[model samples]
Target: MTSFLDEFAQAPNLKYLNHAAVSPWPKRAALAASRFAEQNVLLGARDYPEWMGVEQRLRERLMRLLNAPSTDDIALVKNTSEALSFVAFGLDWQAGDQVIISDEEFPSNRVVWEALQPRGVEVIQVNLKGMDPESALLAACGPRTRLLSISSVQYVSGLRLDIERLGEGLRQRDVLFCVDAIQQLGALPFDAIAAQCDFAMADGHKWLLGPEGLGVFYCRAELREQLKLQEYGWHMLEHMGDYSRIEWQPARSARRFECGSPNMLGTMALEASLSLLEEVGMATVGKLIEERVLWLQEGLERLPGIQLHSPMNPARRAGIITFSLEGHDNQVVFDRLKAEQVVCVQRGGGIRLSPHFYTAPKVIEETLAVLHGLAG
Candidate 1:
């Protein structure tokens, strides 16, 4: 097993704090991708059986990472948005049916729900700013509430919702619980089975440290045939390789969501990347990321002009800490951080800094120092 530091061959000049967007691939993932490319160059589909094995491993890894009921519950989708769309459009919705969501959701989560408005489905946006956001969301769920679609950790604010409570609460109501877990999955321990959620989706590009085009969508085993298939192709059939078979139906598992050819290259990278996280263990990963985020939070709190947008409590946050200088434009702060090689982004009226578990302490310290110096 390679040491975590040995795995990250990132340059010293690059203080990467942008995992919320795309992530820097670790050495193992890069090597996996290179090996895949080499196989394509030399042997091509002659070794296609081996590729299926890799894809199966990716599914198993995602299943374990999500604490899903089985590997069959996982589907390798292109991204979170695609998976979200499958749910947004597939559900048997009636006119006036409501879907609950937070106001702070990323556009992917927001737009998909809003698109359903033409069908007479109403999108309910609840503010998560107050002390009792979960209660507020639950309260908003009335007779017509069909689903409560929410992000596990808010993108810009790093607000980690109590998914278990929300799931349990919605379970008794006739409302389905769907979690967009891109920001929380790899950064923390997320259990789909434990939460009793109907559906969950997450991209691998964030804390998972994989390529951008790959993600996992976990729909409960019993609910597989429930989501009506929008896209269809040969790949999703149960007898996919048996072209001679006359009987055809979408797969009984969550693989039915995969409508076409697989993203083999992305699967190779994500599988290898997950190898590193499994070795570190999710609990350790969560603890390490929490420390880094808290370090940033505390430093920003001490700064004269900086104001925090993320929660002050560690339990309420996953792996993001956002802040802004009192007098500067968001773009200006973003530009300064970029110029300094302290990679960050401007979001939710502030600068969002997301550091992974492997991020060194010095990088966080230096980034904060540079930010304070610039503000001063």
Candidate 2:
């Protein structure tokens, strides 16, 4: 039997630990994209309908990955930021309406809400430093609070939130819950229905191991039309292929959010990447990544002058682990690691390392060995 790790044949000496930012495509995904390009070059639009089948499959796969109620709930968007914009600008915000977010949000989650300030909507940044983060977020939701948009896993600190609890609480309070699931979708088992989220979005490039320009946006069935549509085109029309029709409305399905032609090239890669995930099984994938994170955490804990920034509890984290050296600046440590071909990032006041399920144990060992040399 062929080892699954062979699908990710990276440079022998390169220790890649930055899946949270962008992931290299699996061999299958790369081949899929290449084949797509070849088809485009040779036959052009002759096989376009077949390509649409791939796009449909991509939507179906995303629906399965998100545990969504139906494929009707999934919209193929350009990225997480664009999906967030759909929700931000779509809502009918009153002057006194309040939107609550966390202090540690990536600018995608924070800036969208902040942009609403011109509409007289107040954006509240809640501190998640307390023992009970869910409770703290819930407490911030008052009479005028309209919605709570949060990341399933904090991008910087690698703090995974109790999403089910927060979602249920917001549901009871009649508050809209939106999840920025870019970091969690492929790294952990995610369920939009179980979380009771009104909206959810994730980019395919991160943990999905797809290209950067394509992503999935999930809207609850009931709230689909409640969000005002900002863009329009033939694809988003109710009668999509009926070019001669004089009158038209947006699609009743989640397709309404997709204003223009789909990223067929990106679709080819993402569909192939997701097929790989389905084959591995998300449960198995999550377990492997957790093992890697625990291994990294244990190694870092034993090293001198290493200060952990991410949550220690296994239940409170996903694939990310971050730490800082006691005597070295974060940039200095990050540059040193980069110089050695340890592909990582400087984030959340420290050096952030994110390993996917396919990451080799040798990579983790080599990273620890490098840190050991730095300590000495």
Candidate 3:
């Protein structure tokens, strides 16, 4: 069996447990970037076509990542924000059209929909604090609801939604389904086609272990034409290679979402990173991450004078567990963990710890030991 842990030779003091935020790139990904840099320094643009092949591989990898219907359904964008923006502003909004969203969405998901305010579109913030979160969201939908934009996993609470159920429910009502999958895409088995999702976007920086500037957008093949192109460039043209042609139009595929030059450097890193995921298999990746999460959850529950803020249900989680000590403030605990070489973050009401499949056991043990020391 190929051990994922064998590749990571980090510092003896380092305990990286924050994959939900910015992630540390793997050794192979780092080597890839270094090679790319070396190429740039040694001979710039000498093998540009080879780089384009890498970019195409990136699109193919993303198609596999989101289980998009085809490679034609994938677009390499700058980030998730730009993909969400394409769907937000490109849509022809009516005066009474309503966009449904959860109250716990990250600003990227919330702000884009809210930006449609001047176009007479209303963004509805649905409370997802009930026994059945999917049901709560489905119940909030009314006749005028045009689309439901949601995060597959809540950033703070780490509550994973049943996107398939949500998609089926919304599709029955003819509502568009857009999922911000940054927290769930690389962490779990995210299938956009299985969910019947109209749009899915995720940044590569977090769980994908890729660079910050590039991400993936998956638009359902049918919905590609529905969105009117807002941004245009020579690259997005159908006849991109034919510079002499006067008449041109945007690509009929998901490449229509791309408005500018491609990010080849980002493509190199993300493609190499995704190769690891494909080798391990996302189903196994999800199970291994769940195992780590369960270990942390069980350990956290046993600790005295601690409160678990993230959801307890295994059915509703991906790669995050959150907690707060009884008397300590979030920052104090965060700094203490930081000093101990535990890479975690302060989110929601407390500290958030997110570990990936290869997170060493000692990291969790040391984190609990630190918490135990704090409790005393």
**Residue-wise C-alpha lDDT for candidate 1, range 157-272, written one tens digit per residue:** 99999999999999989789999999998899998977889999999998899999999999987777878889898889987888899989888888888888999999999999
- Write one digit per residue (lDDT tens) for candidate 2, span 180-292: 99999999999998899999999999999999999999999999999999998999998998999999999999999998899999999999999999999999999999999
Q: Provide the lowest-lDDT 10-residue window in model 2.
A: 1-10
**TM-score winner, 1 or 2:** 2
Show the colliding residue pairs in model 3.
Answer: none
Which candidate leads in lDDT? 2
**Residue 124, candidate 3: how far off, in angstroms?**
1.0
lDDT of 3 by residue, 223-340 (tens): 8998988889877888777889988899888888888788877888888989888888899889989999999999888877789988899989999999998878888999988999
Q: Which ten residues in a row have the lowest lDDT in candidate 3?
A: 1-10
| TM-score of predicted structure 2 | 0.99
Q: Which model is ahead, 2 or 3, in terms of lDDT?
A: 2
* RMSD of candidate 1 to true structure, Å: 1.1
